[model samples]
Target: MEFFNKTGKVAVGSRLRMLTEKITEDAAKIYEVYGIGLQPKWFPVFYVLSAGEEKTITAIAKEIGHSHPSVSKIIAEMGKKGLVAEQKDKTDGRRNMVSLTPKGKEITIKLQDQLLDVNAAIEAISAQTTHDLWKAIEEWEYLLEQQSLLSRVVEAHKKREAAKVTIVDYQPKYKAAFKALNEEWISTWFKMEATDYKSLDHPEEYILDRGGHIFVALYNDEPLGVCALVKMDDPDYDYELAKMAVSPKAQGKSIGWLLGQAIIEKAKQLGAKNIYLESNTILKPAISLYNKLGFKKVPGRPTPYERANIQMELDLRS
Candidate 1:
């Protein structure tokens, strides 16, 4: 109780352990009152062997939901007390089959009547409570099966990190990440051309220094996606949205949508009257996203790459 006061209700494992110890202590007391020298922990193995079938250590461990080592140790103790005996499995020489001895069988018969009294006492305790502890424990076990505590914790951590994603202006440190993200999608869909290599290998020279801007989407300061607004030669308002790609691992987290929105906003701020992009019609998701962002199909323009079948343009002037 003092430990509960210090740790509060969050120490679930500690509280459960305290409850188990208390119940075990009460069971020991009940066995002593009946003049039975058997420990409460040994009951599981004894009950299993009493089923009149010799079971291997592995089988007993599985049935009792205890580790093989723990069951083996308990069986060793029971062997010393003349309550159980082990024999080499006939089929498998490596396995040891266990069964209750004559003394163990006699003890089980004697304790059969005592079991009703112990059950009544426990039921009386449960009757005083508003909720059934056993039912609550069963529900808790089912919920844990659907999603483990570790998985829930990991999902929460991923959400926390995803929320931290920020669209940042390109920096030298992010150059490698920029190339990797773009290359992942591009190479998967189409072979990377010389133009792709030029832009990816030298973003600063080919994009940034050419009166253009590059944005990197970062989650927890790690770059996960990249988008670029390439300045056109004819007019300042004309721009090309190119070299946009998101890491495959970060696909479902909407890193692509984040980068798209960021680049659009950046273009608007920089006096972009028209934004153009070249993509393949086979890239359905990307094309759909572009359409949602108000990009309409436009006349195909001459491009350096063979995969450029679909051309789309977004008019910012409207």
Candidate 2:
């Protein structure tokens, strides 16, 4: 109980289960006080049978919202105690219908006074609570049906994980990670060229020194993604969005999107009218991410690398 209280909302499931066990235990004691030998676990099935409906086992299970096997087990226990009996359906010989036996009907007659008293006690208990548990449970179930606890938990997990990733300005310490992440993706599709190595190996001279900015996505002080907004010498564009890559460990964590958005904002901050990028259509996910970042395919320009086939540009003015 102490541990549950300490955990609070995080232990909601455990707390609810514990609470149900407590209620069931009290219900058994209450029935004992009324001189009844019925098991609290069998109450739901008994209640459905006592309504004077000779229902098929399948129908009983559906009406009571329990598994057929569970209802079957309860009926078997009741049958041994001579509380319930089953017979073939008159219209459907294959269907096994069930109803309360004489003993069960007698118990129902005896339960009327106990039921009224129990109902009053429950009303008194509910009056003591600031919020009604019954209405809250119904509302909570409706909300869960709309967006399940699994989805809400997964979204929270993603948001918390993404929060751990910090976009920081490139440092000399992150040079190796920046190069390794980009090189891994590049080598997976096409061989690296001299232009790639020159920029990767000497980022300060080739990129930062020329008024361009490099950003690193770091999680727990380790770089997980990298991208460079290279100062372009072209007459048409102000920056080249180049060498974007995320570590495999950071896949599905929105690392690429974060790095891309950071670089685009940086380009816009530099008073750039447009951004250019070179790529091949073979990298579908990358192309999709680029397109989502508002980059559109444009006519190709002369490139320094042989793998360059698709050219894209993002108009910052728009």
Candidate 3:
């Protein structure tokens, strides 16, 4: 049995990167299930606060992998939610120091205990396994720190926003161009697997078989693009915008934008206040589209997808 040989930092880095998401997601779920009172986005804030030092927003943002505005917004929200408090730094009147409140401290202690328990569980399962897990995670964090992953994530996020697509709902005949459109895009742009552009035989299966919706972008009788509104299991969550694809031949025409607008409108029509999309950073244009449509950067470890690698959401007041 012969195996292919591989070496180099990118190869190692890429392999390790896969764990970045799965571990982050598992950690978040554990914290949430334990009622730890902190969202994944606030992990860096918690880490900073745990250091027992009063830090300004600028310092905190710099230390963590997040933009100043992003940190400020999360901090503001945390304060509102009673997780933290803000006070002017007496030594420097211009600087505001953010620190955990009494409640925040209490929550942090609980989270710390939960963290220890999680570690203990892993250790109990196997000491060697526990050590390797921490080692890999630490290396991944160090790499992200060196690369300023937050900034890259932010930039990637901005690209998605700039690619905002408006959605519109119309008849199937109006979408006759969808088949050709996907074929061109798959061939020219993404070089996607053949399976990526397959047609949905059971249109009603999408609409009624499970949580689903249908949206089509029409250029007269031509279907320039298509997207779906998928219902998730979480009641607190609204529907997700999935299966977004554009015609390779119509890439620059903003047909994708029309589809986005249509999805939002349709989501509102269904009484949904939040709409989300799943995509990837590699597809820079798609990420830009989501950002331009009002999606904010969320600290989520995204999984792979054929055409996208990032997940974004829009809040609608209806």
Candidate 4:
């Protein structure tokens, strides 16, 4: 009777749901102080309320990506809890309109405040991490939306499509080649002189050395770009970003931002509270990408690398 029984697809789907539930539980716990029943299942209702539209059950269900029947059941439950109410649609007696009660609206404001507090706390932990979190969320949302669109297309013949990647680890085989590529990239892409060879080590060695990682973009089986993470030994410093570059052929692809993102994720995974970068203002495009990725200007130590005339750092936890 269970069509999905023992299916790999079913298992994968269930696991994803379980992970989502766990995250939802954590968020709900954080927001519990607001005294609103802001549980995982109620997110659709809250989203509707925030959108501020009085809509029929069918319309609300479609907007929230749920079935009308399921949405109706949720509305009924919310009504019982005094969070929402349903009234017969004047234009269509068969349809019921849904709206948030005053209590629901009041609780939403508190939840918003709690969310802002969460952002601030994250930012307080690490500047590099703050930007990383936002970028990660942005990437996650982009992928989710992309997947949803692909799903719709597939349900109709099929359809498709692709990171500012943060660099985490470097490939030893590509080290010498990447270093050369990095130098070429800095000169060509950022119009800065390349200097300093801290020594030849495998990408893994550097990753472990810095308590971070590295990443490379490849084209035609050749290393085309690279980035890295360097942890701060001092508690006051948090972390530092280093050795990011992309080949001339890879220019205009925004691969640097992708490498930057990879670096951010690496730092986050390594338990870094903040991540800072050393760079120059003349690298306008790179700076713009960083800002778009949520990196803000902050006073910091100058780049020790001879070519870096400007230095910028980002808080990671936010």
Candidate 5:
């Protein structure tokens, strides 16, 4: 517990492992006291086979909520201990069937009586705790299922790395990244056309000089993502969200989300009522990101780019 004073904030895995080891140590001793020749690790497999029915290896793994290889290893270990029997299915040589042997059935009889006392012992211990440990563990498991620890940590790391991405206004030096990033994505998915070149090759004349704004995301002094808000004269919309592209090498770093958020904020600052965008349905990730930013599909308008099949708009008033 003294180690918690320094590393409690990041010691969740350590703490869980410590508790598991302590419980397993006591469980082994408890099994010995009951004269049950079972390892704590083998309890789950034993429980599954205790139903007195033969099940395929895959079925056993599914019932126990474990991986096939892991369950197979445990079953093999139990088979060696004479607690379980396994054989290849008569119809299918590839499928293995497992069930409790005579020795296993006898052990289950002893385990039934032993578990009754163990359950009460566990309840007695739970009564002394400030929080219901079993319920807390169940909740923790549900939360982890909703979003695994790996996914949570990766997302956090992405946000942390994205913090280093500095959003800057269009500059002469960034014009290369502005063009290159767009060209990379467009040429990868769709053929670049005159409209694409007009904005990408000459941002100043096509977008900037027309009172539109372009933002570039730079990480470690390298510009990797760019998005432009083009000024429009349409009464229904003020600006068109266009030419957004993040480099292939720079994806999954939250660069696109950051750039999109920045452009939306810039549109609000410019007193825009609605922002419009055009994209192909094949670009699902881009569509999803736009939806996250509150953009919804709207009726299409006449467009110049052949790649533009879907139109969406964001109502700023909402």
Candidate 6:
């Protein structure tokens, strides 16, 4: 009963239909009050014919922004009521020209006076709003022309789905995924070193067995990314956040952010005093992400991996 109010813009098509029905309903009442025996839907075609311009069905449809079949149906109904007549074009036998009959012209004359009142009533309603509804409609149509509503809707859907990515703890099924995902990114940027192979080849021995954790990002149960929190030998509570990688297809979807957050949270849960990571300066986006997660640059130190030229650390205590 109150679908328009409940759904609002989410159901724009339905709301527009409801608004049209309301206007048409009022117009029908106005017609009855003025003793005009005409339906509101017939007004457009009737007014066009009343201008004394004989038009073909295609021309009438184009002028009124309706389909040819719809205009033809209306013309047929008006013909039955003796308000309109269709005549074959002399020059083109296939074309039928439509014109108002004598009775239709008489009805148009009677309705002309009532039309002013209808126009005034509609204008009065529009004046009640702060913004002009008609002007807003024109702007909305122009915007739709520039970029269709369907395109905007599809973009919004993609964003929503991208945001829906989840960080999941490593499971037995994801054992190979943990290595494959990390290898995919590492091989793309730099060749995997012995240290990388040691950890990736034996995640259980080097990671899980050493009181560390691995977290994976999943979208609809498909593994998209992974990050590991390795317990340090110097400080039992310190963790090295490493081996982070997101699949190429899911790279731009913030799966990396989700994976980073999950590992950071895991570090906190493990009572980590600080989380450290090593990276190369060429990885600007990754560095930016680290900075966003409260990682601050620290003095560079000798690292096992040749590619490690930058060092950063997040002090959880502060």
The C-alpha RMSD of each candidate to the native structure, in angstroms, is 9.4, 5.9, 22.2, 19.1, 3.7, 11.6
Error of 1 at 317 (Å): 28
Residue lDDT tens for model 1, 1-318: 787889896698889998999999999998888877799899999889988899998999999899999999999999999999999989989988999899988888888878989899889989999999989999989999999988877777666666778999999998998888888898898888999999999998999999899999987777888899998785433889999887777755667777888888988999889899999999998998899888999987778889999888999989
The model with the greater TM-score, 3 or 4, is 4
> Which candidate leads in TM-score?
5
Question: Which runs in model 5 stand beyond 4 Å of their true positions?
Answer: 1-11, 18-26, 51-63, 76-82, 85-99, 116-132, 233-236
Off by over 4 Å in 4: 1-168, 187-195, 199-207
What TM-score would every model get versus the actual structure?
0.60, 0.63, 0.40, 0.43, 0.79, 0.54
Cα RMSD of predicted structure 5: 3.7
Residue lDDT tens for model 6, 1-318: 486667677888877897899888988998899888888899899988899988998999999989999999999999999999999998999999999999999998999889788789779988897889889999998999999998898778767877778887888789899999888878888899999999998998999999999998888889988999988886433889999988888855777777788888888887789999999888888999999999988988778999899999999999
CA lDDT, every prediction? 0.88, 0.91, 0.70, 0.67, 0.92, 0.88
| Candidate 3 lDDT tens digits, 177-226 | 44455456555656655444343434444443475677776555455678
Cα error, residue 106 of model 4, in Å, equals 67
Q: Write the per-residue lDDT of candidate 4 for residues 1-318, one digit (tens) a residue.
A: 254455655365576677678777777787676565766687776777665678887788778789978888888888888888778889989877788888877777777777688779767856755357557757967887878745654443311111332333555677786668766756564543423344224455545465756677665556677766766676656677777677766664556766777777767777777777767677777778778767777765645566566656677667
- Ranked by TM-score from best down, the candidates are 5, 2, 1, 6, 4, 3
Cα deviation at 219, candidate 4, in Å, is 2.8
TM-score of model number 2: 0.63
Candidate 5 lDDT, tens digit per residue, 1-318? Answer: 889768975888998899899999999999999999999989988898898888987898888789999988998899999988888898989987899999999999999889999999999999998999999989989999999999999999998888889999999999998999999999999898999989998999999999999999998889999999999988788999999999888877888899899999999999999899999999999999999999999998999999899999999998
lDDT of 6: 0.88
